[model samples]
Target: MIKFSGRGLLLDIEGTTASVAFVYDVMFPFVRRELDAYLQAAWKTPALEPVLRYIAQDAGADTFAAWTQDDATEQAKQQRVSAEITRLMDNDIKATGLKQLQGLIWKSGFDSGELVAAVFDDVPPALVRWNEAGKDVRIYSSGSVAAQKMFFGHTNHGDLLASFRGHYDTTTGPKKEAASYRVIASDYGCDASEILFLSDIVAELDAAREAGMQTGLCYRVGNAPVENGNGHPGIESFDQVSIG
Candidate 1:
């Protein structure tokens, strides 16, 4: 067991508790392949306008507005959005607006039993163990809060949402920035030192550490390999972690 002292646990999703392959291989492809279909289906839905607007805004107001002009058919708008979303995915930019919109689209897939989240076998148990021990557990993923909840709700281990206190996404601010961890600590009404952050990325751990939070580098099998663990205690399983 790894020695730790903290009041709560902070977690990264992809490459931490879940397989990176699930995100890069499965989720990204699913979103890319289904983007056009989802856009076409939601074309007339008023709720979809905000998501479309964000896509346009991110792409370029003048160009996208021209694409959305009166003479431009719904199909043209969708084609543009789909192409732009594909570009974002290819570049792997974590845009808040795009992330939320993708969460909405993924919701449909989850509801239809078409998508299932692949959680590590050790995650659910460790979550329960830590939570039961009175340690608060929460997630901080690049994915939206809704998307995080969706994945946990549909995980192979069954509903694990109850094991978490809250979720954080890019909306909280960029993960590689120390200020974001400070903000999260303030929001949680705790000192940064009270939270232990677990992630597969050294830069993220470095950020958390800079904010005075304890950090651990998760080195799970099939996760993207790291050249060095940056001197943080490495965890192969959530079982290795303890917040006490």
Candidate 2:
């Protein structure tokens, strides 16, 4: 029954509001299955050229400006892009470019009714309670801000985007760094002590604590049965939290 009084609620997605399995099983597999075809179909357009450039930059293929500029014939270029994208996915690199591309792919899946974002049962009600109480709720995750919105906006509970104040991603800073939490606190124009941060990762909770925010570790059913070895408060669900 650990409790903290704060006007701002900060949340981590994976292993917190949503099951990590949904990400690893549904989202990652969807991107892997669809990326090559999507790239092949989109290469001719100006819209995808910039995205390809970002992917190529991360792949270390510096001279591969875009699909249109690849040295080989178009067929070979498709093969190269597909291979590079596959290699990155296989390695599970959390590169910003790859994440952005995955989010784009997921947008298609969500729009086509092939994918539905998952949220824990306790989450939506907690979000609504917090909003009604006038507490500012924000998301901070490794997923890009756009991806985070897409996820919340399409969850089974219906659009939860209106419940959020804003979002943060790795672009703001690394999750395990205290400076990042400080930045978010500053961005919200509040003292870190006024924010309560919830995540499944101990290091992230440690970072948030260092930033002067209250912290909790989410211990969902699918997560490891590890003890709260880091001394942070442990919660099994949002039902255990209160903003007001």
Candidate 3:
């Protein structure tokens, strides 16, 4: 068991609190299946406008309108966005725009009961324990903040959103960068040493440790094997972590 005495907890979703397979096998396929239809229906709406702009910017253009200046029709512009989305997905690129768009699409699925987040059994109770103990808990993930909210709000264990105090995504900064953890600590209103960052990736743990946060390497069943933990303590369940 890994015992950590900290005032805050920053968690990673995939392969940590939730299975990586649930993301790659379920959530991702859901996005691909609903992509074109969602874009077609949401085109030019207020909701999609900023997302498209971000996508355009990610593609090295200033705006969606500027990117598709030669497309000559709404359909063509949408098709361009769809194609770019497909390319990003195919390459497993974690672009901000792609994550935002996926979050939007996931909203419908989650609201309609078509999708449910798969968190580990130990997670829900641990969240409650930490919250009750006055440990500020938050999430840092590649998934957008909106997506993270929706995910925790609709997990199979049910409405775990109340446990989290804040959310961070790539918009804050890359997960593997020490600067991002420093920013999270500042935003979370705690000294970096007061937070415990838990993730399945050693690189992320290394980054958080570099930023002065305590770190734990999660060892979930479906997570990729970590040949070297690089000195981070390993825990197979949240129960092992005792936040004071």
Candidate 4:
């Protein structure tokens, strides 16, 4: 059994604490449909110019300023930009534009009643138990912090956002980067050994392991396996996680 010497818990959302289908079928499609409008509105916002410029740079736009132009060539460039942005999203890269775009698109879905973030039946109870036991429960997802909040804020199980002690996104760092877990362990003010990271993705587990944290595979039926060779623990559910 995988064990932790610390008091903090780092949990993943999709395919771990929550269902994979909720992210893949509902959230991803919702964002894909609303991407165009979201980009347009976000592009027009003066406050978001820096973020847009970052996206342009990430997407290989020749010049950041040129990316904001309204000419047909710029429009074509943005189309290519959008495609590349989608690709990064699919790979769960830590792109700021992708995060903002997801937040906007998810706003549409949340407002229209098209979807609700769903967690497993045991999640809420487990979260409550963990908290009552004085363990900090934090969320780490590729999705933006805003999207993460919206999900728990409007979950099928009701507003579970209150249960989370902290929220992290790609803004912290790419999920597969060992540095991100180090950042999180530091943020939690605990030794990496005291923090237990739960996720369905093996690569993320590997990264967390490299960062010196205890790791667990969520073991959802449809999700990928977390290889333990890199220092992650394997478990099927919160039920399998024993903290004494």
| TM per prediction | 0.92, 0.89, 0.97, 0.86
Candidate 1: minimum summed lDDT over ten consecutive residues — where? Answer: 62-71
Q: For model 2, how does the per-residue alpha-carbon lDDT over 1-244 read when each residue is reduced to its tens digit? A: 5575678999999999999899989998998899878877777787566566767777666645543374558777777777776777798666666776777778888888788889999999988888888888999998878889999989989988999999998778889999999999999898999999999999999999999999989999787566654988888989898555
Which candidate, 1 or 2, would have the higher TM-score against the true structure? Answer: 1
lDDT for each candidate structure: 0.84, 0.84, 0.94, 0.79
lDDT at position 42, candidate 4: 67
lDDT of 1 by residue, 7-94 (tens): 8889999999899998888888888778777887787688777666666666666444654786367677677677777778888988
Question: TM-score for model 2?
Answer: 0.89
How far in Å is the alpha carbon of 225 misplaced in model 1? 1.6
Runs with alpha carbons beyond 4 Å of true place in candidate 2: 44-46, 57-71, 74-78
- Candidate RMSDs in Å, in order, are 2.2, 2.5, 1.0, 2.7
**Candidate 3's residue-wise lDDT over 1-244, tens digit each?**
7676778999999999999999999899999999999999998799999999889999999987889999988888888988999999999898999999999999999999999999999999999899889889999999999999999999999999989999999999998999999999999887999999999999999999999999999999989989999999999999999765
Clashing residue pairs for model 4 = 6-194, 215-233
Q: What is candidate 2's CA lDDT for residue 227?
A: 60
RMSD of 2: 2.5
Least well predicted 10-residue stretch by lDDT in candidate 2 = 63-72
Pairs that collide, model 1: none
Number of the top-ranking candidate, with TM-score as the measure: 3
lDDT of model 4, residue 49:
61
Show where candidate 1 strays beyond 4 Å.
44-46, 60-71
Which whole-number lDDT from 0 to 100 does residue 72 have in model 3?
A: 85
The true-versus-predicted C-alpha distance at residue 109 of model 4, in Å, is 1.3
Over the full model, what C-alpha lDDT does candidate 3 score relative to the true structure? Answer: 0.94
